[model samples]
Target: MGTSWSARIVDAPPDSAMAIEAVLNRVIAQMSNWEADSAISRFNAAPVGKWMALPADMMTVLRAGLYMARLSGGAFDPAVGRLVARWGFGPDGLTGLSAAPNHPAPWTAIEVEGDRARRTADVTLDFSGIAKGFAVDAVAMALHDLGATHFLVEIGGELRGQGVKPDLQPWWVDVEAPPGLFLPTLRIALCGLSVATSGDYRNFREVDGTRLSHSIDPKTGAPIANDVASVTVLHESAMLADAWATAIMILGQDRGMALATRQGIAACLMQRTASGGQEYMTPALAAMLE
Candidate 1:
């Protein structure tokens, strides 16, 4: 949670800003890996095999994380926190060394029973991929409860829009692209929709001259190595969009586009090439464009 958030709403109540802030704070307290006392940190610190009771919000995020892990066949694992830390992407900071996971696909070992959850292995839970998107959806719901029908919510780069603007226009936003890429700009009307993008250009580290992306491949127990520059996903639920974007990015263009087509996911994948960059749009996204 090292970024900013904003909300653009029509007829916002005086107290709506405070309510939005409260919702964002609540999500941070539950999932921020930077916070030592966050619920996710507590779960990561908890002894393996011990069931820990979690707050409803934390439980919800964890459930969704595990679901995406399974659905993506470990490509979008929430239990890759140890790998994230070793790669200098987490609170552990950068150390010039690498390590492997004790278990392959550690997410499969996570078990959630009602409001309680536990891990069978020494896996660290990180919600970095999906938490921000969920926060956007949460803020949107808060706005609705505040009697605002038309609003747009954004956290970091993920965004969601509901209803329309004062001018009766849908909230239109241009999806992000990697710099220096001469790709066609893609825009979408975020009416009851959410969009999330994962890219190697954003958060990265240089190790002895080689740039390493923040995206850790759960299968490899290391940073992903591919030409995939970024992947964008559009969904009704920002949480799903965020997770899917990360998953598809890890899968690369060929496999990722195939997966997107099979699952009927609206996705756009961009890859770095010798000249510049290449783009691929899945049938789901192409249908939307048409």
Candidate 2:
């Protein structure tokens, strides 16, 4: 919610323009807290004894989240919601400058039944990582359905683009470094693709000169501390890019790079050095950039 978003549509039909706006409104209805009766809230409110029927959109994200959990070895888990809340990232809220509260295992201990899901362990579901990207994709699809062939849809720093801009150039994106700095940009001819980034510098709290990031490792129920300053991912779906970026950040440099390579995900990692400089992309990611 602390991020900014913008969209530009070129050579779009009038109907398509209206449809794009409608789709964004729907996303707000489903995602904004003011619209508390949305599907996500229902799933969160469902009692332990009963399973909730999730909307198709929610289910889509849940399935992808589970896959990402497996792929990242639980480094990225949406079920870390309870832990997030304990640290003030959740609705109940934070402990200020103090350290985040220790949380129990995530909803990974939960059993999912079709549209219904349950946690064997006590945990809350947090879709913060994937939701924005999912929304971006959804918005892009809405535009596409309306016969808009060229556009970039972005929501809270997550984005998906299709076709060529009016200038006939590929959609170019820049991955920002820590403290909100951007270096060499990555350009992509967004025929139909999405990109997302998650970094510690985005939304965080400072405690005694130490900045505590919102991204938590479900494995340790703690914030990850590594040399990596940021991670950006590119994929067919913004949701995948979003979740994978978080996973790679938690996984850190070597292991994260290996997983990205094995999974065939194009990624870039920026690491901070002791000399106050930054290290650029990993070999695999560099190749993708090329």
Q: Quick one: best lDDT, which candidate?
A: 1
User: By how many angstroms RMSD does model 1 differ from the true structure?
Assistant: 1.1
lDDT of 2 by residue, 90-198 (tens): 6556754344334444656657887767656556667888888888888788777777888888888788888878889877776555664444555555558788888
Off by over 4 Å in 2: 1-4, 15-18, 28-35, 95-105, 180-189, 280-284
Total backbone collisions, model 2 = 2
**Model 1: lDDT to the true structure:** 0.90
**TM-score, candidate number 1:** 0.97
> What would the per-residue lDDT of candidate 1 be over residues 223-288, giving only the tens digit for each residue?
889888889999999999999999999878888789889999999998889999899999999999
Top candidate on TM-score is 1
Candidate 2 versus the native: TM-score?
Answer: 0.88
